[model samples]
Target: MYRERASRVVGGAVVWESVSDGVAPVRVLPDGCVDLLWSSRRGLLVAGPDRTAHLSVSGPGERWVGLRLPPGAAPAVLGVPADELRDRRAPLADLWGPSAAAPAERAAAGRPAAVLESLARDRLRAAGGADPLGARLTARLATGVPVAAAAAEVGLGARALHRRCRHLFGYGPKTLARILRMRRALDLARAGVPLAEAAARAGYADQAHLTRDVRDLAGLPPATLLLG
Candidate 1:
């Protein structure tokens, strides 16, 4: 089973989950968010922004606590380009090395979510905060704004915008738009919107468009995602 809640200290969500039976495949759908995860058995790992469903298998009796970082925060907080860890689960030691990794390891022991927030704040204090432009771009894209217009609004040309997106979000603007659209559709459906209306509201050409995107991003059909 799994349970999650919002974090007051962090920009996104935090979750605690347990699995007691034999290892089972867990479909983690794309949401353009990065997760800092801790397991009693496996220690600290960063679950990177995914372009497709990430099927995770956990050991029996495994317990996990995770903090999901909002886009644009990962690079500043995790001290790595989003592109470097895209579609990957990486050991914190690999990026930060032993000295920095030691503190993160210690943080895993007590209040991992709060520790993650503190670490992010400290990193921002030293390295400066996430790009303000990136945050603005994310907001624009989340509302289905065209990439070209978003780029112009942010005063960046196409190539520069693409490069900045790779650094800040691990993918180009188009991919980020698709992920944001999918999340918006799911949120609408979960809130009891009809699938057809949700698709319309989320900027899809039609329900089929929504279905195709959901299948590609989530590995599930919209009907199954909403009703099952």
Candidate 2:
């Protein structure tokens, strides 16, 4: 079973928990976010942003909880560039050493989601808060704005924008825009919009364009995603 709720401590973040039953693998699609995950079996790890889909495997009855941080938000809390963690999952202990072990210990006691949120809240405070630029870029790009236009709106030149995106989002602005657009299309489709209409509304040239983009990022076409 899988469920999720919005995080009160982190803006644009979600608190999610899953219990695997060994039925099938889970397909984790790109979402332009990073996750701090705690597994009953594996303890604490950080899931980085992905440029494409990720397949997750778990043993039956394994419980997992995660605090997912919005794009541009995690680099500050994790104290590392987003690009460093891209397409990777690293133990929290590897990132913060002994300090990271405490949260895992506390989470094991119970109320894992609350424990995770407190950790995020504390670390975010210590880091002087998540990067505002990440929120800004996310807001602009999510609206389907062109990368150049988004960069100009954010007061960044091309090279500067690419550098900032790599540090904060783990990809260049063009890739970020494409991923965001793909997600938008999926959301619209999920809302019962037809693929053609969803594609057009989400900034794709047409349904065929949407299919190619979705397959590139998610390894499945829109219809398959909606079926799930």
Candidate 3:
């Protein structure tokens, strides 16, 4: 049987929880806000305004769907300038969806894991459309090359790439690279590797660079999340 783990952060006005492992995707509650999400498995993610967070129940691929307005709409939904939406943090529930709250409650209640699984399946059914640009972006990210080089490889001019990336992922190439780099570092850190070694292998300039990226993207120091 596959095991599952989850963690919650409270104490602020916004409550956040993340669930991982097992086969089901966690449902996120809609709290009327935008969210920033990153997927560790495939380097795929979505940042947008939404009412719920849904996951694919049939498989473990990192997939997400939601409604995001054009860059001009960022200020209206996220309370930030259009450019800032790429890096800003909003309420997790508002960004992901209403269903996210359910798993936390279930886990707290010690309910059977299967209950969450069912919810994931249901959410997956509701998740629609494969964002074409998102798919292209993930394919480029998997190559582990620099963004400019990746954009060239994909036949997109620098400006064109920036526009498309912002339209689809809510961030430009640099921000997405940082997010992916941190995710890669996290995977390495979890594999029992030393911090320096992991940082090097994951393509950071140094351990300090990796540390800074981790803190920025995950809102915690690397050692706390990676080691603990």
Candidate 4:
């Protein structure tokens, strides 16, 4: 149900196959590159190399405004209320909305700065007071530490961390950590390193752990994408 494609906009070439109609909890692998996701009724969700997720709904139609957020910007932007956007029938749509065109147009127009400013304004309005635990957790995630250890390091219990992460990032901390780790692994793989090496460098227990993380996040085995 979920589909994805890696493409080069300026070159106008389909660099990767598109993932279509994905089910909930889709795993997007680390590809050593970034992407701008657009769906007809699902709006837009921009994911970063650090496993940050940003969701936004398009006004209507195919016109979209692209916002190239800085790394670590998701926590700040995912401030919108879930119920206010769309029905939770489709988790993707509920996270984003049904307007994918605005971002496309913004990208074509080359006004990413302006688009980000607008998104920031909207986020500020939706976000409640900042959650310090979320900030601390993100910092630990960046280091590729295990979530359990990270939670303890931040003086938060596992359940408390999970609740706060869901409230802030729309997913659990473990999910975010996997995404982040996969992203890091992909970076190493793309750099021409061995998969096993990349996995270890990214903090996986071993190559198998790395493979599981990559498969869970990217929906493809690490070797398939990187080695093939």
lDDT (0 to 1) per candidate: 0.81, 0.92, 0.48, 0.52
Q: Which stretches of candidate 1 lie over 4 Å from their true place?
A: 8-10, 13-23
The TM-scores, one per candidate, come to 0.91, 0.97, 0.49, 0.56
lDDT of 3 by residue, 101-185 (tens): 5544544354323333343334424443223455556556744678988888778999998887665555577766666667677
Q: Candidate 2: give the clashing pairs.
A: none
Candidate 4 C-alpha error for residue 214, in Å? 1.6
Per-residue lDDT tens digits for candidate 1, residues 75-180, read 8878889999899998777777785566666765677656666666677677777667667888899999988999989899989999999998899999999999
Indicate which candidate wins on TM-score.
2
**Per-prediction count of colliding residue pairs?**
0, 0, 16, 26
Stretches > 4 Å off in candidate 3: 1-129
Candidate 1 lDDT (Cα, whole model)?
0.81
Best by lDDT: 2
Model 4 C-alpha lDDT per residue in residues 29-116, reported as the tens digit of each score: 3321222333334444454432332233333243332333222234555434211221122232344455434654563465443444
